[model samples]
Target: MFWHRATDYILSSNYMAHRFCYLLQPGLIWTNVVMDSLIAASYLLIFLALFWMSSRLRQVAEINRYVWIFVAFGTFIVACGMTHVMEVITLWWPIYRFSTVVKTICAAASVPTAILFVRIAPALTRNMERFIFMLSTTQQEKDRALTSLIASEKLAVAGRISASIAHEISNPLESVGNVLHLLRTGAGLSPEMQRLVDSAQGEIIRAGDIARSTLSLYRESAAPVEVSLVPLLQSIIDLQAPALVRNNIQIQTRMRATVAIRAYPGELRQVLINLIQNAAAAIGEDGKIFVRVQPRRGGYSITVADNGPGVQPADRTRLFSLFFTTKGEQGTGLGLWLAHSLIEKLGGRIKFRSRTAGEAAIRGTLFNIWLPLGTPPYVPLAPFSSVQAGRRQMQKTASVASR
Candidate 1:
C-alpha cells in the first residue's frame, strides 16, 4: 500500500508540472502535454476525494462545518494552481501568451483564503477566551459551595458556646437593672450606699460588655443603620487593638472620604474586622498594615494590605476558592470567601492582589472592597416599648459619641 501511494505521488507531481507548461499556450496540443494535463486533473480530483472524506469525518464526529468548508475550498484552489504550474513547466519550455493571465487569476483566488484566516483567527480567540472564563467561573462556584458546607459545620460547633454566652448576658443584665433601680428610687438607701451602688453599677456594666462581646460574634444579622465611616472604623480598630498589638502588626489608617452610607453598620464592621485580622495574621511580627478608604466612582473603596509573607504563586489563583487555604491547618479559608459574598450582596465588589516577589515582603496581599453609594440600610424588628426604643437609639448615639 505504501509503494502504491508513493508511485501515485510521483505521477501526480509530473502531471502537475506538465499542466504548468500547457497554460502557457491556448491551442498547443502536445500529446504529452494533453496526457499530463489529464493526469494532473485526475490527481487534483484525489484532493477533492480527501476533501469529501474530511466532510464525512466532520459529520460523524460533529466537527464544525465552517472549518470543513475552509479546508475544502482552500485545498481545491491550491490544487488547481499546482496543476496549472505543472503544465507551464513540463509541457512547454518557454513562456506562452496565457502564462501571466494564469498567475493573475491564481493571485486573485489566494486573497479570499488569506482574508479568511485573519478574520477566523480573532473569532477563534474570542470563543476560546469565553470558554475558559466560563470554566473558571464554574470551578469558583463549586469551591464556594464546598466552603459554605464546611463553615456551616463550624457554626454548628460554635452554636453550643453561643447558648452559654446568651445566658451569661441575661443574668448580669437583670442584676444591673435591679441595682440601677435601687439607686434611682433610693427606697431606704443611705448616702454611702449611693457610692457603693455606683461602683457596683460600673462592674455590672463591665460584665454586660463582656457578654455583649461574646454574643456579638454570632449576630443573626447586623441591623442596618445610617452610619458614618469614621466612627465605625475607629470602633473596629479599638476592638481589634489588643490583637493588633499582640501580633506586633501596626495599622496605619488613612481616610480620604467622609461618607455616610446606608448599611448594616455591624455587618460592615464585621467585614472590616475579618479583613484586618487576616491582614495582621499574614504578617508575623514587626509587620505593617495599611487600611485606606477613598471615594470611588459611585461608591467607596476600602483596601486592607499587610507587609507579611504574601500568597504563593500557585495559590493566588485559588485564593477565593472555598477551603483552599494558604495558611494550611491554621486557616479556615472561608473568611475571605464569606467576606466576598457579604460585600457582593451589599452591592459591593471585593478584589485582591498578591505579590511574592520584591523587597519588604512585597509578598503581601492587597484586598480592595468597593461599596456603592446609596445602599439601603438594614431594618431590625421593632422594639416592644417606645421607652425601650428610645433607649436603644440613645445607646447608639452614645456609642457613636464615645468613638
Candidate 2:
C-alpha cells in the first residue's frame, strides 16, 4: 500500500517537494552561526586555492594523472563549503535553494572523475613500472632514452596527458547525440528537419570514431579490426557528400568487394578521406571522381581516381615521400604521406598512376591502395630500453618536418 501510494503520487504530475530537509538537531540549525560562517569561509578559501593550483597546471598543459583527482577533491570541498554557507543563510533567507543546484553539479563532476581515475589506474601502474625500469638501466642508456624522450617531449606530453581527458570530450558528445536522438523521435516534426537530424547523427558517429581511434593510437594495441570496406567507404562518402556536392564534384562508387578484412578502420577511413579530398581539390569544379573497391587474390584494391589535371611528371616520384605537397601554401603535405604511412602499417601499400594533359587525352590521377585480407596483427617494434615507441614518434617527426 505504501509503495502504491508513492507511485500514484509521482505519476499524477505531482513533482513539487514540500520543503528542504535539515540534518541538524531540532531548532539547533542556526544556534552556532558565528562558528559555522567562519568554518564555511575557511573551506571556501581552501576550494579557491585548490582550484587555482589545478587550473594553473591545466593552463601549462601539465595535467598529470593526479591533477584531475585533486580537482575532484576541490569540488568536494566546495560542496561542503557551500552547504555550510547555506546552513547559515537558511536561518534568515532561502538562499540555500541556489546552493542545492551547486551541490548537484559538484556531485555530477566528482562521480565521473572518480570512475575515470579508477579506470586509468592500471595505466598509471604500467607507467610507474616503465619509469622504474628506465631508472635501473645504465647511464648511457638513460642518457640516450632521455635524449629521445626530450626530442619528442611535445608528443610524449600530448600522448601521455591528452589521452586521459579525451574521454571527457567523448562523454559530452554522446550526451549531445542522445539529445539529438530524442529530438529526432519527438512528435510534430517535418521531413526536412528529419533529414537534418539524420545528418547530425552521422557526424556524431564520425566524431566518436575519431575519438576512439585517437585513444587506441595511444594504447598502441596492434590488434587488427575486422572491417568491411563497402559500407565503410560508403559512410566516408556520405560524410563528405555535402562538401563534394557543394564543390560541384560528381562522385561515383563501385563496390565489388563483398568481404571483411582485418585492418584498422581509422587508418582506412583517413586514407579514403585524404584521397577523396585530394581528388576533389584537384578538380576544383564540374569534375568526376570515382572510387572503386574490388577483390584480388589475397587482398582488396581500392582506387580513388579524379578526372582533374594529373600529377606533373617531375613531382610524381615524391608523392609518397614525407612532407611532399603540391598545394604549396595551402597544403601541409602530410595528407598523402600520412595515407602512405597508415597503409604501410596496415600491412599493405599504396600505388598511384597519373597522366598530365601533355601525356594523355584524359588527364587524371588515380591512387590505388592494396590491403590484404585477414592480415595478422604484428607486434609493435622500436622499443627504446623498456617502453616501445608509438605513433607519437611518427607524429613528432611529421611535426618537425612541417616546421
Using lDDT, give the best candidate's number.
2
Question: What C-alpha lDDT values do all the predictions have?
Answer: 0.68, 0.75
Question: Can you give the lDDT of residue 364 in candidate 1?
Answer: 82
TM-scores for the candidates: 0.49, 0.49
Give a tens-digit lDDT track for model 2, residues 302-365. Answer: 9999999999999999997655789989986667876786788788889999999999998999
lDDT of 1 by residue, 275-357 (tens): 88888878877899898888999878888898778877777787776666777799877777667766876778899988876
> How large an RMSD does model 2 have?
30.3
The TM-score obtained by model 2 is 0.49
